[model samples]
Target: MTDTMNAVAYSHALPIDDPTSLEDVTLPVPAVGPHDLLVKVVAVSVNPADVKVRSDMDPDGVPTVLGFDAAGTVAAVGSDVTLYAVGDEVYYAGAMGRSGSNAELQAVDERIVGTKPKSATFAEAAALPLTTLTAWEGLFDKLKLTAESMGTLLVVGGAGGVGSMIIQLLKARTPGIRIVASAGREASQEWVRSLGADEVVRHGEHLTEDVKRVAPEGIDYIYSTNTVGQMDAYIEILNPFGEIVATDNPGLVDLGLFAGKSLSWHSELMFTRSVFTTADMVVQHELLTTVGEMMDAGTIRSTMTSAFSPLNAEQLRLAHASVETGRTLGKVVVTNEPLAS
Candidate 1:
């Protein structure tokens, strides 16, 4: 293996349109830790997390690579790693504090990695890791949903990456539950319906009215993917003791608003387990395994909406730009052209 690998990184927190925001560079390939797998990254997907890190975190002019999701083949395994070996196909969202998947090679913990679905291409599988993990954790873990769950779930921002996954996971995992998604645009509304949403609401001053129109009984659960200026509407339309799980932080929200209904709020962060090295980090592996099996069985599908080839600074910048627009139909993936020696 070459000592150095091609990568894209940000030396400053600048706007996506700025030419210096992301740059092409060469760095030494990361060393594999005992629990780490050295993956030859073939494809990667851009999440809002990547865009946030690029626009909000300054590295003091140091190059900070920012990619969360990856699909690749294991080039080597550390001594203590038993989950995979050389040449095993894998996909994962790497930990937050460590280097990410923007490189041609990356070292990620095996407990958080999963075997890629046999039916998917590298790009398709790459799109699944970050958004899939986020949606799964929000629905099953945060909302405490199960196969027997029955009631209505309102998914805010259902046309985005996490929302698309949330709609599909609810359908696959809890068939008895009905899903209502919010989308402002006609195309986005159709997009969520194709993914299994039973009803679609518009996001506006009339948001609560639309929810009331679709499910007059009130929402039993809410997965709030975008909660800017809409928490009041949620409280008004949610049933007593209903649960709401959010992935976005929409500034300072009044916590006391839910007291009237005795409602609860929960937040989901997919990076929590790996960043803290929790004992249940293996849960990510298991859940991802389940998702892979579901994909292979044709029960669920990939969310990839756009693709780019020959991984480099130019292609990566384009991917980040698309994600920042907040209008992407689903996930966007970029494939690596073979790295030069």
Candidate 2:
């Protein structure tokens, strides 16, 4: 193989409106770290993180690739790698500081990746990792919710990617709990219901009021996947001592509001462990492996709803635009080869 490969990169934080904001280029194949595996990326999925990073990361004059979710075959492994060997099908959300998966090949730590789900296509599996980790961590690690846990969970922006996963995981793992999902449109509401939500709250309606109409005592857990700008509404609807978790950054929230209810707030960032090289970093690998097994066992389903093909600059730009709309039903994926038209 050549030392360089095709990739999409950006040198500055420009608006998606700018034609040159994301460009197609060739970059060296990243060297494998002692614990890394070199994956020949077959597919990748776009998330809000890609859009945010494109607009926020100051690349200066150096080009930086931006993508997180990926599924592919392991082409090579570092000397110290043990979890996988060449030709293993795997999936993972790449680390924040790495070159990312918007390329022909990427080197990622073995501890953060999992064996790909046998029942899923590369595109389907690619749509899962980042969102899965985010939702799983938000529900189990942060909120400590389980199948036997009692009370209601209110999922805001329930039609989006992470919200969809959260709903499915809750249904598959926590059947005993009641679920309320917030969505504005008819289609979105129906989508949430199909995913196993017990109640649907319209987005514009008063959250606290709508939640009370169902649970009467307000919700016991709040998972805000998006539109974090309305965090105050979530705080108001949460039952006293209830916990709230958010994957998006809720800018300048007033924690004092939670003080009255003795509520606990958690910010779920799936990249934290990889970013800081935490001792428990391998937990993500274990969790993803479990999710893969669950998928193969038909316990949960893939969330991929949209797809583009022949992963290139134009397709990636289109994917970014779609995610920027912030109304995507589930997940959007891009494959290295074009789908038959």
Candidate 3:
């Protein structure tokens, strides 16, 4: 109900250590467009995209708001919005083209939003949207893996948010699929294993040896949450008809490695549908809802392992710094208060 709201924004890119990198500003509450819902943001989660946007802002462009994942209550709905109503608690990863959920309130398309799990707090729900969307699309959509398939899944960077979620979803839904995750540290190794990875290996070390130690044969599906270039050594370990899906853009990779094995390669970008308004845009809504149901059923758990209180520039900066390190065990969330159940 407030006319103005507090937000963290930047007109130019600056290093995380710079005092001006992120600023607290007051702006008029945004009005919702048709098919959009205005949300009162209670919590936000930081991803690598948020760090990239904050540190890589174009000087010539407008001041950019740089948050993606949000869990909040609906403040108002546009005239054409029929999926959600005021006071409904929802979770979503907002599109890249518009103002993001870093503000006190944001206007987001209802098609991408889903009802938050009643069993989860706002911060927990906030941690799910971005990472879950990326992992779900990478495995099921890009790689075309189904729950009925019987095979092994290898997740690189398994300790990270998307990787952790991918491991959990596959273990919960896919029968007879063995999951082998790559993590260097003990904490990360234990974290992914706890999330249902059948086996864990160190990334920088030899992947083939570690994986072979567990399954003896090669893996059937590979989801690389780390850089693609880091995956070259493991391609040969993929089965003849195996599929590899990666979200990281490592420039100029040789395709011959996969071609020889008759393997398929896929690049998954969670923003693709929202950016292009693709024919299958509603698939995101369906996936998010499914994820919420799984969460309610206790088949999957939120990846939110760390939380910062009082959503503000300093707290957001800290979260961004943590994500930029690329060593976080799970998703990091920033909330206005300790999330209420």
Candidate 4:
């Protein structure tokens, strides 16, 4: 194999409105670390993280590739990597500190990847990892949810990527839990319902009222993927001692506002395990493997709604624009080439 490969990257932090912000380039295939697997990427998904990274962090003159979620086949593995072997099909949301999965090849920790679902296409599997990890961690890990904890869950911004997965996973894992998703648009409301939400309400300044209309007793948990600026509204809708978990960093949030109700607030960052090389990093491997099993068994479905091909700068730019709009119904993906398998 050649030492270099094709990749789309940016050297500076620029607005997505400028097409030049992300461009095609050639870079060396990343070297494998002791626990890493070298994957030949087949498909990748764009997330809000890609846009935020490109706009906020400079690549320091080196072209920095930006993509988080991907599905591919293992081409090589580091000496200490035992979880995956060459020729194994895998999927993962790669670590944040390294070169990313937008390239033809990526080196990711084996502890973070799963065998790709047999039921999904490459593009479909690619759409899942990041959002799935986020939703799973947010729901079960951060919220300490279990099947026994079945109660009303109010999912704010239910039409987007993470929200879609949260709705589906909640139903698959906790069958008896009641879900109320907030979506203002007709299409979004319908989408949330299709994913197993018991009730759909319009998202507005009066979210508390909207939720109360269906769940008169108030919500037991609040999962907000967007609209963190309206934290007060969510807090008002939560039952006393309820928990609120968020994926994004909402600025200057005051936890004291919910203190009176003894509400708990948690932020779920899926990269924490991989980034810190935590003792339980293998938990991610377990999570992804279980998710793959659920997907293959039809217990859960792929949330991918759109796909683009040829993995080039223009296509990536378009994908980034869609994520920036904060209106995409589910997930959007781009393939390295046409998906032959």
Leading candidate by lDDT? 1
Candidate 1 Cα outliers beyond 4 Å, as residue runs: 337-341
| Predicted model with the maximum TM-score | 1
Q: What's each prediction's TM-score? A: 0.97, 0.96, 0.95, 0.96
lDDT of each residue in 1-341, candidate 4, tens digit only: 89999999998998897977999999998999899999999999998888889889997778889999999999999999989899999999999889888899999999999889999888989999988999999998888788877789999888988889999999998877899998988999899999999999877776877787999988999898775467878878889999989887788988789889999888889999988999999888889889999999998888888888878888888888888887788998998657554
Worst 10 residues of 3 by lDDT: 56-65
Candidate 2 stretches greater than 4 Å from native? 227-229
- For model 4, the stretches where C-alpha displacement exceeds 4 angstroms are 337-341
Clashes of each: 0, 0, 0, 0
Candidate 1's TM-score reads: 0.97
Give all candidates' CA lDDT scores.
0.91, 0.89, 0.87, 0.89
> Which residue segments of model 3 deviate by more than 4 Å?
60-62, 339-341
Give RMSD to native, each candidate. 2.5, 1.5, 1.8, 1.7
Give the lDDT of residue 325 in candidate 4: 84
Q: State the lDDT of candidate 3 residue by residue for 112-161, as single tens digits.
A: 89889999999999999988999988877777667777888899989998
The RMSD (Cα, Å) of candidate 1 is 2.5
Worst 10 residues of 2 by lDDT: 226-235
